[model samples]
Target: SQQGEEDPQALSIQEGENATMNCSYKTSINNLQWYRQNSGRGLVHLILIRSNEREKHSGRLRVTLDTSKKSSSLLITASRAADTASYFCATVTSRLDSGAGSYQLTFGKGTKLSVIP
Candidate 1:
Protein backbone atom coordinates (compact mmCIF):
# COMPACT_ATOMS: atom_id res chain seq x y z
CA SER A 1 0.00 0.00 0.00
CA GLN A 2 1.09 3.61 -0.60
CA GLN A 3 2.21 5.73 2.29
CA GLY A 4 2.91 9.40 3.02
CA GLU A 5 0.91 11.67 0.76
CA GLU A 6 1.89 15.31 1.25
CA ASP A 7 -0.50 18.24 1.34
CA PRO A 8 -0.13 21.11 -1.13
CA GLN A 9 0.95 20.04 -4.55
CA ALA A 10 3.56 22.82 -4.60
CA LEU A 11 5.12 25.52 -2.47
CA SER A 12 7.38 28.46 -3.28
CA ILE A 13 9.66 30.30 -0.90
CA GLN A 14 12.60 32.67 -0.88
CA GLU A 15 16.02 31.42 -0.03
CA GLY A 16 16.79 31.38 3.70
CA GLU A 17 13.15 30.90 4.65
CA ASN A 18 11.74 27.78 6.18
CA ALA A 19 9.49 25.25 4.42
CA THR A 20 7.06 22.84 5.92
CA MET A 21 5.33 19.78 4.45
CA ASN A 22 2.86 17.33 5.91
CA CYS A 23 2.24 13.71 5.05
CA SER A 24 -0.48 11.26 5.95
CA TYR A 25 -0.35 7.51 5.49
CA LYS A 26 -2.90 4.69 5.55
CA THR A 27 -1.21 1.59 6.91
CA SER A 28 0.99 0.14 9.58
CA ILE A 29 4.62 0.52 8.56
CA ASN A 30 8.03 -0.44 9.75
CA ASN A 31 9.53 2.98 9.19
CA LEU A 32 8.87 6.30 7.52
CA GLN A 33 11.50 7.92 5.31
CA TRP A 34 11.83 11.31 3.72
CA TYR A 35 13.65 12.06 0.47
CA ARG A 36 14.42 14.88 -1.91
CA GLN A 37 14.30 14.67 -5.70
CA ASN A 38 15.91 17.39 -7.72
CA SER A 39 14.54 18.32 -11.11
CA GLY A 40 15.22 15.52 -13.58
CA ARG A 41 17.33 13.67 -11.07
CA GLY A 42 17.27 10.70 -8.71
CA LEU A 43 15.80 10.74 -5.26
CA VAL A 44 18.15 11.07 -2.30
CA HIS A 45 17.42 9.89 1.17
CA LEU A 46 17.18 12.61 3.79
CA ILE A 47 16.20 10.68 6.88
CA LEU A 48 14.40 7.55 8.01
CA ILE A 49 12.74 7.28 11.38
CA ARG A 50 11.15 4.02 12.42
CA SER A 51 7.57 3.72 13.58
CA ASN A 52 8.92 3.35 17.07
CA GLU A 53 10.63 6.70 16.77
CA ARG A 54 8.63 9.87 17.25
CA GLU A 55 11.08 12.33 15.76
CA LYS A 56 14.29 12.58 13.81
CA HIS A 57 16.50 15.30 12.37
CA SER A 58 19.33 15.70 9.92
CA GLY A 59 21.17 18.87 9.11
CA ARG A 60 18.46 21.34 8.10
CA LEU A 61 15.68 18.76 8.01
CA ARG A 62 13.36 17.94 10.86
CA VAL A 63 10.73 15.18 10.84
CA THR A 64 8.12 13.99 13.27
CA LEU A 65 6.04 10.86 13.31
CA ASP A 66 2.69 10.18 14.96
CA THR A 67 1.92 6.52 14.51
CA SER A 68 -1.36 6.84 16.28
CA LYS A 69 -2.66 8.88 13.39
CA LYS A 70 -0.36 7.57 10.68
CA SER A 71 0.95 11.00 9.84
CA SER A 72 4.31 12.74 9.57
CA SER A 73 5.66 16.18 8.93
CA LEU A 74 8.86 17.60 7.49
CA LEU A 75 10.42 20.98 8.12
CA ILE A 76 13.35 22.43 6.27
CA THR A 77 15.09 25.22 8.13
CA ALA A 78 16.79 28.06 6.25
CA SER A 79 15.89 26.77 2.85
CA ARG A 80 18.38 27.22 0.03
CA ALA A 81 18.03 27.30 -3.73
CA ALA A 82 19.72 23.96 -3.57
CA ASP A 83 16.80 22.80 -1.52
CA THR A 84 14.39 23.43 -4.34
CA ALA A 85 13.13 20.01 -5.13
CA SER A 86 10.23 17.61 -4.75
CA TYR A 87 10.26 16.22 -1.25
CA PHE A 88 8.83 12.73 -0.76
CA CYS A 89 7.96 10.67 2.23
CA ALA A 90 8.12 6.90 1.89
CA THR A 91 7.44 3.76 3.82
CA VAL A 92 10.49 1.65 4.57
CA THR A 93 9.42 -1.93 5.10
CA SER A 94 10.87 -5.38 5.39
CA ARG A 95 9.72 -8.84 4.31
CA LEU A 96 11.23 -11.89 5.94
CA ASP A 97 11.98 -13.49 2.61
CA SER A 98 14.22 -10.71 1.30
CA GLY A 99 17.97 -11.11 1.21
CA ALA A 100 18.70 -7.43 0.72
CA GLY A 101 19.84 -5.10 3.53
CA SER A 102 16.23 -5.73 4.56
CA TYR A 103 13.74 -3.17 3.31
CA GLN A 104 11.85 -1.95 0.31
CA LEU A 105 11.15 1.75 0.18
CA THR A 106 8.04 3.04 -1.56
CA PHE A 107 7.64 6.76 -2.16
CA GLY A 108 4.59 8.96 -2.49
CA LYS A 109 3.96 11.56 -5.22
CA GLY A 110 5.74 14.26 -3.17
CA THR A 111 5.50 17.97 -2.47
CA LYS A 112 7.26 20.19 -4.96
CA LEU A 113 9.18 22.87 -3.11
CA SER A 114 10.69 25.80 -4.95
CA VAL A 115 13.20 28.06 -3.27
CA ILE A 116 14.09 31.23 -5.14
CA PRO A 117 17.45 32.92 -4.94
Candidate 2:
Protein backbone atom coordinates (compact mmCIF):
# COMPACT_ATOMS: atom_id res chain seq x y z
CA SER A 1 0.00 0.00 0.00
CA GLN A 2 1.02 3.61 -0.52
CA GLN A 3 0.84 6.46 1.97
CA GLY A 4 0.73 10.23 1.72
CA GLU A 5 0.34 13.34 3.88
CA GLU A 6 -1.61 16.47 3.10
CA ASP A 7 -0.60 19.82 4.51
CA PRO A 8 -2.91 22.31 6.23
CA GLN A 9 -5.73 20.11 7.43
CA ALA A 10 -8.16 22.86 6.60
CA LEU A 11 -8.42 26.12 4.69
CA SER A 12 -10.84 28.99 4.33
CA ILE A 13 -11.00 31.43 1.49
CA GLN A 14 -13.29 33.91 -0.16
CA GLU A 15 -15.02 33.26 -3.45
CA GLY A 16 -13.06 34.33 -6.53
CA GLU A 17 -9.77 33.80 -4.68
CA ASN A 18 -7.21 31.18 -5.47
CA ALA A 19 -6.65 28.04 -3.38
CA THR A 20 -3.62 25.88 -3.07
CA MET A 21 -3.04 22.46 -1.50
CA ASN A 22 -0.07 20.17 -1.28
CA CYS A 23 0.64 16.46 -0.88
CA SER A 24 3.73 14.49 0.04
CA TYR A 25 4.27 10.77 -0.41
CA LYS A 26 6.62 8.22 1.11
CA THR A 27 7.08 5.66 -1.67
CA SER A 28 7.76 5.64 -5.37
CA ILE A 29 4.64 6.21 -7.40
CA ASN A 30 3.48 5.65 -10.95
CA ASN A 31 1.29 8.72 -10.94
CA LEU A 32 -0.50 11.23 -8.70
CA GLN A 33 -4.06 12.46 -8.91
CA TRP A 34 -6.30 15.01 -7.26
CA TYR A 35 -9.95 14.53 -6.34
CA ARG A 36 -12.68 16.70 -4.95
CA GLN A 37 -15.44 15.49 -2.63
CA ASN A 38 -18.48 17.48 -1.77
CA SER A 39 -20.31 17.37 1.58
CA GLY A 40 -21.84 13.94 0.99
CA ARG A 41 -20.76 12.44 -2.25
CA GLY A 42 -18.11 10.49 -4.06
CA LEU A 43 -14.80 11.95 -5.08
CA VAL A 44 -14.51 13.45 -8.54
CA HIS A 45 -11.20 13.09 -10.31
CA LEU A 46 -9.75 16.51 -10.99
CA ILE A 47 -6.46 15.76 -12.66
CA LEU A 48 -3.76 13.18 -13.05
CA ILE A 49 -0.06 13.88 -13.37
CA ARG A 50 2.31 11.11 -14.31
CA SER A 51 5.67 10.76 -12.62
CA ASN A 52 7.37 12.07 -15.71
CA GLU A 53 5.16 15.10 -15.97
CA ARG A 54 6.34 18.22 -14.20
CA GLU A 55 3.12 20.16 -14.55
CA LYS A 56 -0.44 19.91 -15.91
CA HIS A 57 -3.42 22.17 -16.18
CA SER A 58 -7.18 21.75 -16.66
CA GLY A 59 -9.30 24.84 -17.00
CA ARG A 60 -8.59 26.91 -13.90
CA LEU A 61 -6.86 24.06 -12.09
CA ARG A 62 -3.14 23.51 -12.21
CA VAL A 63 -1.04 20.64 -10.85
CA THR A 64 2.68 20.33 -10.37
CA LEU A 65 4.65 17.23 -9.58
CA ASP A 66 8.15 16.82 -8.23
CA THR A 67 9.08 13.16 -8.29
CA SER A 68 12.51 13.69 -6.81
CA LYS A 69 11.00 15.41 -3.80
CA LYS A 70 8.00 13.01 -3.79
CA SER A 71 5.64 15.94 -3.54
CA SER A 72 2.86 17.56 -5.54
CA SER A 73 0.74 20.68 -5.43
CA LEU A 74 -2.68 21.64 -6.79
CA LEU A 75 -3.81 25.18 -7.47
CA ILE A 76 -7.30 26.39 -8.27
CA THR A 77 -7.89 29.87 -9.63
CA ALA A 78 -10.98 32.04 -9.38
CA SER A 79 -12.47 29.63 -6.92
CA ARG A 80 -16.14 29.80 -6.22
CA ALA A 81 -18.36 28.73 -3.34
CA ALA A 82 -19.04 25.54 -5.25
CA ASP A 83 -15.39 24.77 -4.97
CA THR A 84 -15.78 24.30 -1.23
CA ALA A 85 -15.03 20.68 -0.61
CA SER A 86 -12.51 18.17 0.64
CA TYR A 87 -9.53 17.77 -1.67
CA PHE A 88 -7.43 14.63 -1.62
CA CYS A 89 -4.30 13.50 -3.39
CA ALA A 90 -4.14 9.87 -4.46
CA THR A 91 -0.96 8.04 -5.30
CA VAL A 92 -0.65 4.97 -7.46
CA THR A 93 2.02 2.48 -6.54
CA SER A 94 2.89 -0.94 -7.79
CA ARG A 95 4.54 -3.81 -5.96
CA LEU A 96 5.70 -7.27 -6.91
CA ASP A 97 5.05 -10.19 -4.65
CA SER A 98 6.12 -13.67 -5.61
CA GLY A 99 5.63 -13.58 -9.38
CA ALA A 100 2.62 -11.36 -9.36
CA GLY A 101 2.40 -7.61 -9.47
CA SER A 102 -0.35 -5.43 -8.11
CA TYR A 103 -1.18 -1.76 -8.15
CA GLN A 104 -2.70 0.26 -5.36
CA LEU A 105 -4.27 3.65 -5.08
CA THR A 106 -3.80 5.25 -1.68
CA PHE A 107 -5.23 8.59 -0.70
CA GLY A 108 -3.98 11.19 1.72
CA LYS A 109 -5.86 12.43 4.75
CA GLY A 110 -7.47 15.25 2.74
CA THR A 111 -7.74 19.02 2.95
CA LYS A 112 -11.07 20.48 3.95
CA LEU A 113 -11.62 23.83 2.24
CA SER A 114 -14.34 26.36 2.77
CA VAL A 115 -15.20 29.05 0.28
CA ILE A 116 -16.96 32.07 1.74
CA PRO A 117 -18.89 34.33 -0.54
Candidate 3:
Protein backbone atom coordinates (compact mmCIF):
# COMPACT_ATOMS: atom_id res chain seq x y z
CA SER A 1 0.00 0.00 0.00
CA GLN A 2 1.08 3.54 -0.65
CA GLN A 3 2.21 5.68 2.25
CA GLY A 4 2.85 9.34 1.57
CA GLU A 5 1.23 11.40 -1.17
CA GLU A 6 2.59 14.84 -1.98
CA ASP A 7 0.16 17.64 -2.59
CA PRO A 8 0.07 20.15 -5.52
CA GLN A 9 1.96 17.63 -7.69
CA ALA A 10 3.79 20.52 -9.33
CA LEU A 11 4.52 24.20 -8.89
CA SER A 12 6.00 27.06 -10.89
CA ILE A 13 7.26 30.41 -9.72
CA GLN A 14 9.71 33.20 -10.38
CA GLU A 15 12.98 33.60 -8.60
CA GLY A 16 12.94 34.98 -5.06
CA GLU A 17 9.47 33.62 -4.49
CA ASN A 18 8.47 31.30 -1.72
CA ALA A 19 7.24 27.77 -2.26
CA THR A 20 5.08 25.56 -0.12
CA MET A 21 4.35 21.86 -0.43
CA ASN A 22 2.40 19.41 1.65
CA CYS A 23 2.42 15.69 2.32
CA SER A 24 -0.30 13.39 3.58
CA TYR A 25 0.11 9.81 4.62
CA LYS A 26 -1.66 6.81 6.08
CA THR A 27 -0.63 4.77 9.15
CA SER A 28 1.66 5.60 12.04
CA ILE A 29 5.19 6.71 11.30
CA ASN A 30 8.30 7.06 13.38
CA ASN A 31 9.48 10.16 11.56
CA LEU A 32 8.88 12.21 8.45
CA GLN A 33 11.70 13.48 6.29
CA TRP A 34 11.95 15.85 3.36
CA TYR A 35 14.31 15.41 0.46
CA ARG A 36 15.19 17.29 -2.69
CA GLN A 37 16.14 15.83 -6.03
CA ASN A 38 17.53 17.56 -9.04
CA SER A 39 16.94 16.25 -12.52
CA GLY A 40 18.61 12.89 -13.07
CA ARG A 41 20.18 12.75 -9.64
CA GLY A 42 19.85 11.22 -6.21
CA LEU A 43 17.73 12.68 -3.47
CA VAL A 44 19.37 15.01 -0.94
CA HIS A 45 18.19 15.05 2.62
CA LEU A 46 16.76 18.36 3.67
CA ILE A 47 15.26 17.96 7.12
CA LEU A 48 13.60 15.48 9.43
CA ILE A 49 10.76 15.89 11.89
CA ARG A 50 9.91 13.32 14.46
CA SER A 51 6.31 12.33 15.11
CA ASN A 52 6.42 14.30 18.37
CA GLU A 53 7.84 17.44 16.79
CA ARG A 54 5.42 20.14 15.79
CA GLU A 55 7.73 22.28 13.69
CA LYS A 56 11.33 22.55 12.55
CA HIS A 57 13.44 24.83 10.43
CA SER A 58 16.73 24.78 8.60
CA GLY A 59 18.04 27.77 6.72
CA ARG A 60 15.27 28.81 4.33
CA LEU A 61 13.27 25.66 4.88
CA ARG A 62 10.60 25.12 7.46
CA VAL A 63 8.61 21.96 8.21
CA THR A 64 5.53 21.29 10.26
CA LEU A 65 4.01 18.01 11.35
CA ASP A 66 0.61 17.11 12.71
CA THR A 67 0.29 13.50 13.72
CA SER A 68 -3.35 13.93 14.54
CA LYS A 69 -4.13 14.90 10.96
CA LYS A 70 -1.48 12.61 9.47
CA SER A 71 -0.16 15.51 7.47
CA SER A 72 2.96 17.61 7.08
CA SER A 73 3.98 20.73 5.23
CA LEU A 74 7.26 22.11 3.91
CA LEU A 75 7.80 25.78 3.35
CA ILE A 76 10.65 27.35 1.44
CA THR A 77 11.31 30.98 2.04
CA ALA A 78 12.69 33.25 -0.68
CA SER A 79 12.94 30.47 -3.16
CA ARG A 80 15.44 30.82 -5.95
CA ALA A 81 15.67 29.46 -9.45
CA ALA A 82 18.45 27.24 -8.20
CA ASP A 83 15.94 25.77 -5.79
CA THR A 84 14.00 24.28 -8.67
CA ALA A 85 13.73 20.57 -8.20
CA SER A 86 11.49 17.76 -7.04
CA TYR A 87 10.66 17.51 -3.36
CA PHE A 88 9.61 14.31 -1.65
CA CYS A 89 8.38 13.30 1.77
CA ALA A 90 9.36 10.01 3.32
CA THR A 91 7.89 8.04 6.17
CA VAL A 92 8.85 4.89 8.02
CA THR A 93 6.37 2.02 8.25
CA SER A 94 6.88 -1.39 9.71
CA ARG A 95 5.42 -4.83 9.10
CA LEU A 96 5.42 -8.08 11.02
CA ASP A 97 5.45 -11.48 9.43
CA SER A 98 5.75 -14.91 10.95
CA GLY A 99 6.50 -13.40 14.33
CA ALA A 100 9.29 -11.44 12.71
CA GLY A 101 9.27 -7.71 12.28
CA SER A 102 10.81 -5.39 9.74
CA TYR A 103 10.61 -1.77 8.80
CA GLN A 104 10.21 -0.06 5.46
CA LEU A 105 10.50 3.47 4.16
CA THR A 106 8.06 4.92 1.65
CA PHE A 107 8.24 8.13 -0.31
CA GLY A 108 5.59 10.32 -1.77
CA LYS A 109 5.00 10.93 -5.45
CA GLY A 110 7.02 14.18 -5.13
CA THR A 111 6.27 17.78 -5.88
CA LYS A 112 8.08 19.15 -8.88
CA LEU A 113 8.90 22.82 -8.80
CA SER A 114 10.01 25.02 -11.67
CA VAL A 115 11.50 28.39 -11.00
CA ILE A 116 12.00 31.08 -13.61
CA PRO A 117 14.64 33.72 -13.23
Candidate 4:
Protein backbone atom coordinates (compact mmCIF):
# COMPACT_ATOMS: atom_id res chain seq x y z
CA SER A 1 0.00 0.00 0.00
CA GLN A 2 3.05 2.17 0.06
CA GLN A 3 2.04 3.38 3.48
CA GLY A 4 0.06 6.30 2.12
CA GLU A 5 -2.18 8.27 4.42
CA GLU A 6 -1.55 11.75 5.62
CA ASP A 7 -4.19 14.43 5.32
CA PRO A 8 -4.50 16.81 8.21
CA GLN A 9 -4.61 14.38 11.02
CA ALA A 10 -3.91 17.44 13.17
CA LEU A 11 -2.30 20.82 12.82
CA SER A 12 -2.16 24.06 14.76
CA ILE A 13 0.06 26.90 13.68
CA GLN A 14 1.36 30.01 15.40
CA GLU A 15 5.09 30.57 15.76
CA GLY A 16 5.89 31.98 12.34
CA GLU A 17 3.33 30.10 10.26
CA ASN A 18 4.07 28.22 7.08
CA ALA A 19 3.37 24.52 7.41
CA THR A 20 1.85 22.32 4.79
CA MET A 21 1.60 18.56 4.70
CA ASN A 22 0.12 15.92 2.50
CA CYS A 23 1.08 12.39 1.56
CA SER A 24 -0.68 9.59 -0.23
CA TYR A 25 0.53 6.25 -1.51
CA LYS A 26 -0.63 2.95 -2.89
CA THR A 27 2.11 1.22 -4.87
CA SER A 28 5.04 1.73 -7.20
CA ILE A 29 7.95 3.22 -5.38
CA ASN A 30 11.73 3.14 -5.22
CA ASN A 31 12.39 5.99 -2.87
CA LEU A 32 10.41 8.70 -1.12
CA GLN A 33 11.28 9.60 2.41
CA TRP A 34 10.68 12.50 4.74
CA TYR A 35 10.81 12.13 8.44
CA ARG A 36 10.90 14.34 11.51
CA GLN A 37 9.66 13.64 14.98
CA ASN A 38 10.36 16.03 17.81
CA SER A 39 7.98 15.28 20.59
CA GLY A 40 9.92 12.63 22.33
CA ARG A 41 12.48 13.15 19.60
CA GLY A 42 14.20 10.36 17.63
CA LEU A 43 13.21 10.23 14.01
CA VAL A 44 14.96 12.80 11.88
CA HIS A 45 16.07 12.34 8.31
CA LEU A 46 14.01 14.81 6.40
CA ILE A 47 15.08 14.24 2.85
CA LEU A 48 15.28 11.50 0.27
CA ILE A 49 14.11 11.58 -3.30
CA ARG A 50 14.50 9.01 -5.99
CA SER A 51 12.32 7.26 -8.50
CA ASN A 52 13.39 9.82 -11.05
CA GLU A 53 13.16 12.68 -8.61
CA ARG A 54 10.70 15.53 -9.00
CA GLU A 55 11.58 18.19 -6.48
CA LYS A 56 13.45 18.42 -3.23
CA HIS A 57 14.92 20.94 -0.84
CA SER A 58 16.45 21.12 2.61
CA GLY A 59 16.95 24.20 4.70
CA ARG A 60 13.37 25.21 5.43
CA LEU A 61 12.15 22.11 3.71
CA ARG A 62 10.29 21.91 0.43
CA VAL A 63 9.44 18.67 -1.28
CA THR A 64 7.18 17.88 -4.18
CA LEU A 65 6.52 14.82 -6.25
CA ASP A 66 3.61 14.01 -8.49
CA THR A 67 4.22 10.52 -9.75
CA SER A 68 1.17 10.98 -11.92
CA LYS A 69 -0.64 12.38 -8.88
CA LYS A 70 0.15 9.68 -6.42
CA SER A 71 0.56 12.74 -4.22
CA SER A 72 3.37 14.19 -2.12
CA SER A 73 3.75 17.65 -0.69
CA LEU A 74 5.52 19.10 2.30
CA LEU A 75 6.53 22.69 2.67
CA ILE A 76 7.62 24.28 5.89
CA THR A 77 9.04 27.66 5.32
CA ALA A 78 9.08 30.35 7.99
CA SER A 79 7.82 28.01 10.62
CA ARG A 80 9.37 27.96 14.08
CA ALA A 81 8.57 26.53 17.47
CA ALA A 82 11.27 24.09 16.68
CA ASP A 83 9.22 23.22 13.62
CA THR A 84 6.85 21.18 15.72
CA ALA A 85 7.02 17.55 14.80
CA SER A 86 5.34 14.48 13.29
CA TYR A 87 5.66 14.64 9.55
CA PHE A 88 6.41 11.37 7.85
CA CYS A 89 6.26 10.01 4.32
CA ALA A 90 8.32 6.92 3.80
CA THR A 91 7.99 4.71 0.75
CA VAL A 92 10.50 2.22 -0.56
CA THR A 93 9.24 -0.80 -2.42
CA SER A 94 10.50 -4.32 -3.06
CA ARG A 95 9.28 -7.13 -0.84
CA LEU A 96 7.00 -9.10 -3.09
CA ASP A 97 8.77 -12.20 -1.85
CA SER A 98 12.22 -10.87 -1.07
CA GLY A 99 13.34 -8.91 -4.03
CA ALA A 100 16.11 -7.41 -1.92
CA GLY A 101 15.98 -3.79 -2.93
CA SER A 102 13.82 -1.99 -0.44
CA TYR A 103 14.80 -0.02 2.60
CA GLN A 104 11.83 -1.22 4.61
CA LEU A 105 9.86 1.74 5.83
CA THR A 106 6.16 2.27 5.72
CA PHE A 107 4.79 4.95 8.01
CA GLY A 108 2.00 7.41 7.68
CA LYS A 109 -0.85 8.68 9.80
CA GLY A 110 1.32 11.68 10.58
CA THR A 111 1.03 15.42 10.16
CA LYS A 112 0.44 16.24 13.78
CA LEU A 113 2.22 19.54 13.86
CA SER A 114 1.57 22.05 16.58
CA VAL A 115 3.98 24.91 16.63
CA ILE A 116 2.08 27.19 18.84
CA PRO A 117 4.01 29.72 20.92
Best of the candidates, TM-score: 2
| Cα lDDT tens digits for candidate 3, 51-79 | 99999999999999999999999999998
Candidate rank order under lDDT: 3, 2, 1, 4
Model 4: how far residue 58 lies from native, Å: 14
- Estimate every model's Cα lDDT from 0 to 1: 0.89, 0.92, 0.94, 0.83
The Cα error of candidate 4 at residue 95, in Å, is 1.4
What tens-digit string does per-residue lDDT give for candidate 1 at 10-112? 9999999999998988878899988889999998989989899998888889999999998999999999998999999998767558776587777788999
lDDT of 4 by residue, 1-117 (tens): 437788788889998888999898887788788888888778988898887889989888998988887778888988988887899888877776766753567878688898888
Cα deviation of 45, candidate 1, in Å:
0.7
Off by over 4 Å in 1: 95-102
Error of 4 at 28 (Å): 13
* Poorly placed runs, candidate 4 (over 4 Å): 1-14, 17-29, 33-50, 54-61, 64-75, 80-85, 98-105, 108-114
Summing lDDT over every window of 10 consecutive residues in candidate 3, give the lowest-scoring window: 94-103
- Best first by TM-score, ranked: 2, 3, 1, 4
Superior by lDDT: candidate 1 or candidate 4:
1
In candidate 3, the residue pairs with backbone N, CA or C atoms under 3 Å apart (3 or more residues apart, or in different chains) clash, namely none
Q: Estimate the TM-score of every prediction.
A: 0.89, 0.93, 0.93, 0.34
How many clashes show up per model?
0, 0, 0, 0
TM-score of 1: 0.89
